[model samples]
Target: MTTPAQRQTALLVSVVGAVIVALDGTILLMAQPVMQRDLGASVAHIQWTSTGYLVAVAALLVIAGRLGDQYGHARLLFVGVLGFGAASAGIALAPSVGWVIVLRVVQGGFAAFLQPATLALLRLAYPADRLGKPIAIRTGAIAVAAGSGPLLGGVLVAHLGWRAVFWVNVPLAFVIAVLALTVRTPATQRGNSPRLNVTSAGLLAIALATLVHALADVPARGWTAAPTLLEFLAVIGVATMLTRHERRTTHPVVPPAVARSVPVTASMALLLVTTAGLFGALFRATFHLQDVLRLDPLDSGLRVLPLTVLMVLGSPAAVAAMRRYGARRTAIAGTVLVVVGIAGLSRLGPASTWMAMAAAFAAIGAGFATVMVTATGTVVGDAPPGYAGVVSGLKQTAMNIGPTFGIAVAAGATGTAASTMGSTLLILAALAALGLLPASRLPRRPARQEGEHDTTAALPAQAPTPQAAPARHTNS
Candidate 1:
C-alpha cells in the first residue's frame, strides 16, 4: 500500500529533478557569452547549446512519456535523473563547444524523461480534489526555475564561470536520483510491461519535429511561404496517418481514451496557447528591456522575477480561489487575467517603469499559476487510472511547444523593437484571450470547501476504455 510519507517523498524527489531540467533551458543562454569566448565557439555553434537540447527533448517526449506509463514513473525518474547528472557533468568538463552541444543534446534526451513522469507522478501523489496546490506548486517551481535561470546563470558565470551552471545540477540530480530509488514502486510497476507502438511513436516524433521546425521558420519565411505551408501540410498528413495507425494498433502509443478525452485534449490546447503567449511575450519584452531601457542582463533577468514570484505565491491562493470560484471559472478567470496582462504589456513605452512592467508580468504569472493548477487538477483528476503519464506527456508537449510558437510569432511580426514588441504582445494577448474557449469548455465541477483538508476524497470515477491497459503493469 502507498503510504502518505512515501507519497510525499516521491513528490519531493521529482521536484528536484524537475528544477534542474527547467533551469538548463534558460541558464545556458546567459552563459553563452562567457563560454563563447572561453571555448572559441562561433555564435552559430553556441546557439546549439539550447537548440540541440530542446529539439531532442521535444522529439523524445511522447515516446518517453509512453515508456514511463509502461514502466514505473519512479524508475523513469531515477534513470533520467542519473543520465541528466552524467550529461551535466560531461558538459561542465567538455573541451570544445561541439562536445558541449553534443552533451547538451544527450542531456535534453534525458531531460525529456523527467517532465512527463514527474507530472504523471504528481497525480499519484495527491488525490484529485486535493491536487490544486501541488499542481500550482509544480507549475510554479518550473516557472521559477526557468524565470531565475538567467539571473542564476549571470551570477555563476560572473563568479565561478559558465561551467558552474552545469556543475550546479550534478549534486541536485544525485540527490534526486538517490531518493527516487527509495520510493516504493506503485503496484502497476511490478507486473509484466507492454511494448510501445514504435511506428506510432516514430510518426509522432516526425510530426512534432516538423511542426516545431515549421513554427521556428515562420519568422524568416512567412507562414504562407511555400516551405512553411508545406511543413504544415506535412504535419497534417502525418497526424492523419498517426491517428489512423493508432486506431488500428492494439497498443497505440497514445491510447484512444487519452486522445479522445475532452479535459486532456482541451487542457493541452490551453497549455500550448498559454505558454506561447506567456513565454513569447516575455521574450519580446526582454529585448525591449535590454536594448531600449539599457538594463544589464542580470537586472533584466531580475525584472522577470515578479512573474515567477507571483506564480509561486499562487499555489496557496489556488485553493481559496478554487473553493470560491470552482475549477472552470477559476481557470477562465486566470486566463482572462493573462489576456489582460498581455494587453497591459502592449502599452509599454520609453517612459514605462520597470516596476510597472514587473507588476504586469506578475499578473501574467499569477494567471499562469491559476490556469495550471485548475486545468491540471481537472485533467489529471479525471484521467483513467492507468494513463496519467500519457496525459501528462501531452500536457508537457503543449507547454514545450508553446514557447517555440510564441518566439516564432514575435519574430514574424515586423517593426522596430518597440513597435514589434508591442504588436507581439498584443498578438499574444489575443492568443491568450482564445484560452477562454477551452477554459469555458472545462467541466463545471463543484468545489471542495476551503476548510477541507482531506486528501482521500475519491476522484470522479471513469469508465475503462478499450485502449486502457490492465492496471497491473511492469517497469519495462
Candidate 2:
C-alpha cells in the first residue's frame, strides 16, 4: 500500500521532473541566440539543437513508455533523470555546437523515458478518483515553469552565461533522484510479459520522426517542395505499415486496450488540437512582439505573463468545474474560451495596446488550462493501471505533435514577416474552433465518484490478476 507520505513524495518527483523538462524547452529558446554567437554556429546548425531534440523525443516516446511498463517506472525514472542531467552537464561544457546538438538529442532520449514515467508514477500513487487535484497541481507547476522560463533564461544568460541555463538542471535532477529514492513503488506492470514487437516500434519511430521533419520543413520549404513532399509521403507510408503491423502484433508499443479506449483516444486528439492552437498562436505572437513591436526578449515575455498567471490559477478551477459540470461540459466551455481568445488575437496590430494582448493571452491560458486538466484526468482515470505508462506516452505524444503542427501551419501563413500576423492568427482560431468536435466526445460526467467502487479493471490492492477485465467507457 502507498502511504500518504510516499504519495506526496511521488508527486514532488513528478512535478520536479516535469518542470525541469518544460522549463528546459522554453529556457533554451532564450539562450539560442547567445549560443549561436558564442559557438560561431550558423542558423541551420543552431536550429538542429532544437530540431534534433524534438525529433528524438517524439520518435521514442511510445517505445520508452513500453519499456517503463515492462521494466519498472521507478527504475526508468531514475535512469532517465540521471542520464538527462549527465547530458545537460555535457552540453554545458561542450567544445563546439556539434557536441551541443549531439548531447541535446541524447538529453531528449532520456526525457522521453522521464515524461511518461512522471504520469505513471502518479497513477501508481493515487487512486483514480483522487487523481484530478494532483494532476491539477502538476499542470499548474508546469505552467509556472514554462511561463517563467524565458525570464529565468534571460537572467541566467545575461548575468552568468548561456551555459548557466543548462547547469541549473543538474541540481534539480539530483533533487528528484534523492526524493524518488524514498518512495516505495511496488512492481506495477501486470499481465503476461509478452515479447516487444521491435519491428512495429521501429516503424512507429520512423513515422513520428518523419512527420516532425516534414512539418518542421513547412516553414522553411514550401509544402510543395520536393523534399517536403517526399518526407511526408515517407511518414504516410511508414504509418500505414505500422498500423498493419500493430493490428497483428500481440505486444504493440501502444497497448491494444489503450488503442481501443474511446475516451483515451479522444483525449489524445483533444490534447493535440488544443496544444496546436495554443503553441501556434504563441509562436506567431512571439515574433510579432519582438520583431514587429521591437520589444526585448524580457519585455516580450512579460507581456504574456497573464497567460501564465491564468494557467496557474485555472488548473485548480478547472478541476472544480469538472467535478461540478462534468468533463464534457467543462471541455466545451474551455474550447469556447480558446476560440474567443484566438479570435481576439487576430485583431492585434502594430498599434495594439499591451492590455489588449494581455486579455487575449489570459483567455487562451484559462481555456487551455481547463481542457488540459480535464482531458489529462480523463486519459489517466479512464484507463486501467496496467497501461498507464503507454497511455501517458500517447498523451505526451499528442502534445509533442500539436505544437509542431500548430507552428508549421502558423509559420506557413506568416512566413518571415509579421505583416500577416492578423490573417495567420485567424487561421489558428478556426483550427482551435474545430477542437469542439473532440471536446464533445468527453464523458458527460465521471462514471463514478471518489469513494465508489471503480468499474474499470484495476489490479487488486492485494493480488493483481490477468483475468480482471479493465472496464472501458465509450460515452459514459
Estimated TM-score per prediction?
A: 0.91, 0.95
Q: For residues 368-444, could you state the per-residue lDDT of candidate 2 as single tens digits?
A: 99889988888987666667777888899998999999999899866757778889888998888888998898888
Candidate 1's residue-wise lDDT over 1-476, tens digit each? 35788768767775766777888878888789899999999977886787677777888887887787777778888888899999999999999999999998899889888877787786666545555666666767877788888888888999999999999999988888888888763554424335788899999988987887788667667768899899999999999999899889887888766776676777778778888888788878878888888888877778777888888887668656776666678888889888888888889887988778888988998898888777777667666555677777777788788988988787776533665777778998998888888877766655654234334333222322223222211000
Q: Each candidate's lDDT (Cα)?
A: 0.76, 0.84
Q: Could you tell me which residue pairs clash in candidate 2?
A: 457-470, 457-471
For TM-score, the strongest prediction is 2
The parts of candidate 1 lying over 4 Å away from their true place are 189-194, 217-227, 449-476
Model 2 misplaced regions, further than 4 Å = 189-191, 446-448, 455-476
* Candidate 1 residue-wise lDDT at 152: 85
